[model samples]
Target: MGKPLSGKVTVVTGGSRGLGREMVLAFAEAGADVVIASRKLDACVALAEEVTKKTGQRALPVACNVGEWEQCENLAEAAYEEFGVVDVLVNNAGMSLLYPSLEQVSEAMFDKVMATNLKGPFRLSALIGTRMAAAGGGSIVNISSIEAAHPEPLAVPYAAAKAGLEALSVGLAHTYGPGVRVNTIRCGPFDTDIAKAWPPELRAELARHTALKRIGGPADIVGAALFFASDASAYCTGATLALDGGFR
Candidate 1:
């Protein structure tokens, strides 16, 4: 089979580690030049090198804290400056800080979570999706969390932000339709680096609740990501695909 993303350029926020890193590598292997954006320059640089070595596709590493609006603009500018056009964009950068209780959650913590999970995607999609529509067409894949639907007490703010992200995807699809497609991948508990911080019982509980009886692996995300980013889902837009191993 031919490379699915040949001659395409993709940008992935948080493209340095975990699910983001996996997606970056997968996109490159599928024949797409990639722009890897994250807060850590070193990690992004290393992954960029690996991508070039493994797939011979050019990779641009950019340091960006998606929680800030200016940084999001800079990321978009850098990608366009380096690659002329971007065919795919993956909004995968997100965070949820721990707190003693909902009542004790600080304003800063709440804002940071909202900014990273919701605001950043909004800005990037606005900037790039507009260009994509004008230039012809493109795909935008948003990485959301199942917590948006099944909100837990400990993660209410994060869940709210994710819910907003899903809503944003639907709105963006309409805002840039016919030429640009926007979609969301609602993810469940995956055994990514972040899962290492999860307690054992929490992990077991999550697994038991899923029909798959196991948490997701890093590679589990590749199929859905490719589908949304490529022509495999050509007619699909404003849709949400659950990648949670049937988490209930």
Candidate 2:
């Protein structure tokens, strides 16, 4: 396919590793100027440089705590200072708490999960929404999880937070329409730290639940991210696409 996202400027959160880094690299490869933000400045910059070296595209690494409103604001401002305007947002930073139930969840664990996975996206989206609205329009892709749809009972808190994230996407799809597009990607268990809690046997067992019978790599969800960020899905919004290696 052509560089469908050429000339666009996209921002990916949590771009230090795993799916976030993969998406950043993918967008750069697709010819988009990419700005990636994460708490780790060193990792972010290294990733940014790697993408530029690999794709010959513009990439900026910014240090920010997306869960904080001020940092989110700075991320938007810095992106504009770098590229003039942002055309796409991938809210991909996340965390998971795999406790047996609500009673087993800690106060800190619950709050942290809600902040990073749900609140952070909300803060960043509001910033991107205003800019995109003024610049005509833009696209937003929220990274959710299949756990929200077909949850692991032990991960009740994570699943619940992700489910809320899905609702947030749907709500924004309408509330910010005419100038913005919002969608969710419900990703399945991937070969990432997010699944490090599972034992080898447990991981394999979970993999068996998917039609593909394997854990997805970091790059597995890039296609969905591309579709949401590019004109290919220009007519799409308020939708959720599962990139779960055929988890069904």
Candidate 3:
């Protein structure tokens, strides 16, 4: 019942849709000025307005492709310029490439998945974590996937990339400690429109196997995210809070 994160400034990548959008809104509701970023300017701007209106919190909208290092740099700079400092970062920009097999996968397709799903978060966390260290301390939450653990064959690139992200989270914590916390949230099939290529039957199957017996909405992730960004999880670092509802 404590408003533990009052006045904190947090940044969320991919804030235009899905879990990212929900987190940005949740952070605002919890009394944090949020910086929302996405590849689309209109989307980020729109979410910024919505967060401002809904939660009465300061929201800064930024356009950036997290896959590119330079764009990630600009995002951090823009957020800092808008809010003076950032206390939390959510590296949530990601996508998956579903192919039948490794033979069917194009190098370009594999690279795209790896770059966006893994390197993007790595780069963004690096830049933001640096800023956080300079400022004394901060929290970084990277959105990973249960696929990293379960390893879906059709999504080889995705699973591998997310696995790398989880690895980075653990490795990063050792380097960024005393003042910074780095963690990953291994998420399952969310109800966001993000799974455009996933067959409906497969989605249903995924839902059926989970202990919760349902696909989670964006809201299902808000509580864990808030804990990561707030003082509630001050002792947590180098951890992956599996948001998969205990799927097999």
Backbone clashes counted, model 1: 0
Worst 10 residues of 2 by lDDT: 95-104
Error of 1 at 54 (Å): 0.7
Q: Rank by TM-score, descending?
A: 1, 3, 2
- What lDDT is reached at residue 47 by model 2? 89
Please, what are the lDDT tens digits per residue for candidate 2 over residues 97-132?
667667878899888888888899998998888789
lDDT (10s digit) by residue, model 1, range 205-234: 999999999999999999999999999999
- Candidate 2 vs candidate 3: the TM-score winner is 3
Local distance difference test, each candidate? 0.97, 0.89, 0.89
Identify the candidate with maximal TM-score: 1
After TM-score superposition, the amount by which residue 238's alpha carbon in candidate 2 deviates from its true location, in angstroms, is 0.2
> Which TM-score value belongs to model 1?
0.99
lDDT, model 3? 0.89
* Better by TM-score, candidate 3 or 1: 1
